[model samples]
Target: MSATDLSASPSAPARSRTVVASLRLLRSELRIIAGRRRNQAGILVLASVPVLIAVALKFSQPREGRGPDFISSATSNGIFVSLTALSIEIALFLPLAVAALAGDTIAGEANIGTLRYLLTVPVDRTRLLAVKFVSLVLGACFGVLVVAVTGVIVGGALFGLGPTTLLSGSQIGLADALARLALAVLYLSAGLAGLAAIGLFISTLTEQPIGAMIAITVVSTAMWILDGIPQLEWLQPWLLVHYWTAFSDAFRDPIFYEQMRQGLLVALGYVVVFVSLAWARFTQKDITS
Candidate 1:
């Protein structure tokens, strides 16, 4: 039945069954993502960044007082480990991870001859797209947490956790520092969610998962390059990546929330707009595969 028929169905039992099936499909999607070899490898690579950072810090003197304030602070406080690692990864590693997962969502299924089968199984395009987008978001969250959590553990083991120094030169206790790290993780995850939405829309345009993945990465990288150009200062705020590094503001003494809040709003806007575009395109596209 068509999605309209799905909505117009009068039987409560049918609607209830659809909900149950959708939930099961969601679970299946998550399991598939978790088991995918590329995703597993991506997680491992992401987790290693923090460990590497901690180890590097342990062996050498953090440049005394130069480069990413967090670097210099690493020797004095373990909390900097996660923050520094995230700073290093947010520009590429994190976005690429989200791109890999989001780009594979619909395109991957279609490439494997499963898209038509899914539709035949009574899974409407709308619900399927929702499941895919949600899986991407959850994937982004998992990827971000892997980096942050791994960093915290390794950093703590190497440097010992204690009060964290803020960018403003003020200090906060370990409890508060942990909270800020949580906020940064959430912020970066939200930013990646925006990219996932963009990738989801791109995934609908092609049957080749690799093409979609490359397209997503290109789009992400282009934005990064554009946001860095001094001439594009006028357009920087409009770019989604504009606020990615703004997560560091959380480390400021007073905890600057404005940029983070704006970042969230931008991310939310991207999610809504791109997901709507994906739904529109996927609902209308022919699923010959």
Candidate 2:
């Protein structure tokens, strides 16, 4: 073989090795995340939200202004129960679940003294961070899916399943409504991705997992508070949580896209900025733990 051919042959194997190693690292990270008792508890709690909503709605009639408009109609059609539960939890519990998972992606391992050991492996630091991040994002998505799936099951049982009425006073088939629910779940999951990125960035800054969790939770609360203040209206558009409720737009007759589009753009911006920050810090930071 020529010198160029010999050099290129080695490069190909090196790249293949890197890919295999990265996949192994991701699998390990996912297993560790799945085995954690706290993550399991979080998933259980998220799943319970829909059950609670269904039970409560089944037992009582919704009062005006008591909850989302959809709740008033949830008893008539089961799918609305899922949407109502989502609306209730998306503001807090959903994000909290995301925070719980992403907040510990790095700091939790470091606190347990496993981070150093993992870094000592053949894994590249950048690749390691990428795996942790992808795992955390998947974990967050799983949390949302848990809520959506449980909501569907519990809601369908408590209330009869049938066609759904759109927010625009139009009716859609049961299949179409389920499809929209899936899209709404995707939107909500994407919304939480921004928060997960922020949580991952915070996780890199501390050795205590609880500290990272609390810090991100506090940041979420602060944004929520600010978003609620009229005087802070000027800052609402810039806040990460500002357009979270825009997922409701998915249920519109024509499927309103403006708010969801804006929400998605803002979410993507946050993810890019915070994930970049995490990569930069993790690459340079000295891992003593």
Candidate 3:
């Protein structure tokens, strides 16, 4: 049958089949990401942060303000271990791992000469990029969950689990605390998705995977530095890393939504802009690599 005939014969069935196949492509991309040694290493490193923090806090007394408020109280409640570990890693480790994965997505394939062969498949460029972005987000969530779950296990064993205390000095049930932890994870994942989008856009600009990774990492670090400067306080709301710590608001009694809402909006804005840029560039750029 001609190409047109195959496409036209039972259009509804073809459309449904295509949708199913696209879903499978997302799984395939996820597997590809998870199967990578570097990505696995990144996850392991993320998981280890909580373990190390738990062990350290268990053996020694933390000075006030030495770290996040959760760190000072980590010895009191196991739940704080997860929050403390997240607080520690969010500034550097998490973003670095995310940048590594997202930065390598397209650039690595191109560097290894697989991008051309992959493009030879029936997948549209936009579909492929979308699948890749989804996989990156999934991979990031997996990494974050690893840290939280590991924190729970290690912290529970070391300090013993109990009800979580809120920043307002109010107590909450263990179940409620766990639910808040889940919310914190989701918020962090969403923020990391913005970074992934940024990295993906950077990936499309370079054929060298290492170059893309380094560039994104540097950019992330610069933003963090800018966010730290007192003189740049005015730029905080505009900076991507600015509202990252807003996840702590989840632990409050009433659960402060203002900062979290602003953070989510900022993250959403970054994802929209960068993902659009990536799609525009990837769809038009010549596949010479």
Candidate 4:
């Protein structure tokens, strides 16, 4: 017997309908993001930034010590510069990206009044929120991956492949360079995950997307300020922003595995707490708006 017969016999259509609805919603969400010209343009622009920096550095550096013996100093410099740029960019701009994308993910629907339409469908609120959160988080990850790969490719093409050289002393071989870069990217993503969760949490608090965006940015800025205060240095361990710069520790001579582990732990805690807060708040949210 087919699903039709099963539905006609005695089973509630709940499970089947939910599967169909989720697939449809996923398509709609992907279409909405993929079809937006502004989003596409923004991605292209961001992808270009790292490539442009690599090109500029390739041509601008004055000839110095015979680069790195085992590896090209130019490549090392490019990787360092690209990674450093990404770190700074994430610290300064990614909060805005997270706030802008995640903050608007659901609130935008409510603003335009389509949220009620979605609710009109038989879809459960819990499933709907879960799918939306997954889509948004995946999109954020895609953006970060774009930045990372572009940096590495551009650096390799322009400067030539080389060993991983650290500012903290010691040099990494080819295999280690690849491994370190992978770890660096993973570490960076963890930091961004916390930001995304914070943004998502704020999104659940308000119907206005702008309000949510601004609120999260404010939270990021406030955390950064507190993390920097001399008297509040003790609070650094509790601040997510404090770990945003810890990817550099991956380049240390002995590789500060302890610090990396602690950073990951802090990031994981932030993601869990913030996402749980968002879900808890959203579950009780009134659809009246």
Residue lDDT tens for model 2, 25-72 = 788888988998987888898888889888988888567666668888
Q: Across residues 169-191, which tens digit of lDDT does each residue of candidate 4 receive?
A: 66777677667767887787777
TM-score of each: 0.93, 0.93, 0.93, 0.81
**Clash numbers, per candidate:** 0, 0, 0, 0
Residues 25-100 of candidate 1 have per-residue lDDT tens digits of: 8899999999989899999999999999889879975465578778888777788889999999998999899888
Q: What lDDT does the true structure give each of the candidates?
A: 0.90, 0.86, 0.88, 0.74
Worst 10 residues of 2 by lDDT: 60-69
Error of 4 at 231 (Å): 1.9
- Where model 4 places Cα greater than 4 Å from the true spot, the runs are 1-24, 61-77
Give the winner by lDDT: 2 or 3.
Answer: 3
Candidate number that wins on TM-score, 1 or 4: 1
**Candidate 3 per-residue C-alpha lDDT over 1-289 given as tens digits, one digit per residue, 9 for 90 to 100:** 8988877887878778877988998887888887889888888889999999999988886676776688888888888999999988988899888888877689989999889988997678988898889888887787788888899889999998888778899999889988999999999999889899999999999998888888888887899999989998888898788888999899998999899899999999999999999999999999998
TM-score of 3: 0.93
Clash list (residue pairs), candidate 3: none
Error of 4 at 151 (Å): 0.8
Name the weakest run of 10 consecutive residues (lDDT summed) in model 3.
60-69
**In candidate 1, which residue ranges exceed 4 Å CA deviation?**
1-18
Candidates ranked, most accurate by lDDT first: 1, 3, 2, 4
Candidate of highest lDDT: 1
Provide the RMSD of all predictions against the true structure, rounded to 1 decimal.
Answer: 3.9, 2.7, 4.0, 5.5
**Candidate 1 — what's its lDDT?**
0.90
